[model samples]
Target: NGASRFGRLRQTLAGVSEKMLTQTLRTLERDGLVRRTVYPEVPPHVEYELTALGQTLREPLKALTEWSVVHIEEVITARGEYDDRAERTR
Candidate 1:
């Protein structure tokens, strides 16, 4: 939610490859949606946090998540019907 290390973010988002995560983080940072901080230390520590603009997405993202959860079955069913129609045409 707040500041988090790469390892913690990777762990929280299961099944994401390091390369993908790194790329995504870089893109977000580039887009000004996330802030990356590097601390000079023995091994160098880095942390990522949502920028003010990113924080503004919280409610909209949450609403999208809820909508997906509620409409997943319908979406799946529609996909199946579409696939069947496509196959028939083929």
Candidate 2:
């Protein structure tokens, strides 16, 4: 999903600390992957979007998301089996 802003991107990519995410974004921007925009307002506002190279990631990212959603059951089942096998051997 295309976010309206950088804050939105941070929120969407869960479990990332704000500071680390900020630095990561800066690096990506430096690498010419993400575009950052600043809007003048009383407090100021910022937005982040993908550059052409970044946009190319959309399809694979979406596919990965779909795979996680569709194969969640298999993932869980495999995890349980692994844990059980480990416990028996222990």
lDDT top scorer? 1
lDDT of 2 at 85: 100
* Clashes per model (N, Cα, C within 3 A): 0, 0
Q: Write the per-residue lDDT of candidate 1 for residues 19-82, one digit (tens) a residue.
A: 9999999999999999999999979899999999999999999999999999999999999999
lDDT of 2 by residue, 1-90 (tens): 454676677778899999999999899899988988888996789878789999998899899999999999999999999999999998
Off by over 4 Å in 1: none
With candidate 2 superimposed using the best TM-score fit, by how many Å does residue 60's alpha carbon deviate from the native?
A: 1.5
Judged by TM-score, which candidate is best? 1
What TM-score, computed on C-alpha atoms, does each candidate reach? 0.89, 0.68
